[model samples]
Target: MALVIGVVSQKGGVGKSTLARLIACNYAASEWRVKIADMDLAQGTCTSWNRRRLQNEIEPKVAVEQFLNVDDAIKTGEQYDLVVFDGAPHSTRKTLDIADACDLLILPTGVSLDDLEPTIKLAHELKKHGIYPPKISIALTRAGNSDVELAEGMEYVRSSGYHLLDGVIHEKTAIRRASDEGKCATETSFKSINEKVDQLVQAIVNRADELGKK
Candidate 1:
């Protein structure tokens, strides 16, 4: 079975789809048969992004398909080396199902109580549903260049007994602009951002193996 990475968030504009596409883009570039299962059927952000990606002739194409059910999405993953799920921004049975089934569950959020609180609640809810913290990670996304805010966010996530990824996605115009061009922040001219994105990707890939060993 293909390794599944679920990118979930409880609120919109938290970079859920952006994070999913970043990972999927890098994986596809590395020759992994990657597919993004856009779980947000109503929005279809990932699906539409993929169309723009194709139109712009982005390298190492990745497939994006929309699905309403978690099981149906997993079945499609069977044909790929890795499947990245762009989950919806609201609570749903399908969201929990995806969290429980994924090799690694990623909760992307900004560094604030507004983002982390709901995300932590969702994480706790998933824990109650059988997905433990070891299989879940909190990714700091769309963060600004505030050391205090970032430190506080990291500490908050760790104190909640969840893994806080070291490589954070900063709130950069380059990140947003790259995505608009069907590219990832890692593909931009910003070397520091690229390194961070690469680090995050490596950690996630290692996490999949880490969870599998348990």
Candidate 2:
């Protein structure tokens, strides 16, 4: 029973794939047997990222795979401690299918109205499919410490009947640089963003533990 986490959303450029890869790379580096299944065959962004990771020698410790379907992706589920599914944008059917198969669904949205709306709609859609997990959360990415706009976005999410991660990752050049190097934030020398991502991982682990007791 691996703890499967699906990173999903209805919109693109919301950092879904980036979050998935980051989590997978960091968790694996920490000695957790981790696997990442990229379900977005059209873009193959995660898959390509992993490829670059291999070529650049940044993915030495992570096991990443690309799959076109849920069943194929779950084939090695029992072998790993965790499985992360990086989903395609705007694919409700595929997203729901992955939701049904995961222990947790992590919807990553930025601090903006455009990003928030689709996230709320996505939550409702998952509920409608009856595939809602015991733990479904919203994560705030690309945040800024002094930005009043980020605060407004948090207020909006609080009003939407959903839970947001207590730790918000600020928009930093380090994130993009680390990604390009095929390294996770945790593996980079930067501490600010890495610490926040670690907190996000801990929160998910805590929620998954709580769900297991139910």
lDDT of each: 0.87, 0.80
Candidate 1 residue 206 Cα shift, in angstroms, is 1.8
Backbone Cα, N, C clashes tallied per candidate: 0, 0
The 10-residue segment of model 2 with minimum total lDDT is 205-214
On TM-score, the leading prediction is: 1
Candidate 2, residue 79: Cα displacement in angstroms equals 1.8
Question: What lDDT does candidate 2 reach at residue 171?
Answer: 78
lDDT of 1 by residue, 37-59 (tens): 99898899888888888999989
Cα distance off (Å), candidate 1, residue 177: 0.7
In the range 148-203, model 2's lDDT, one tens digit per residue, is: 98889889888887777676767788888887777765556688668867887777
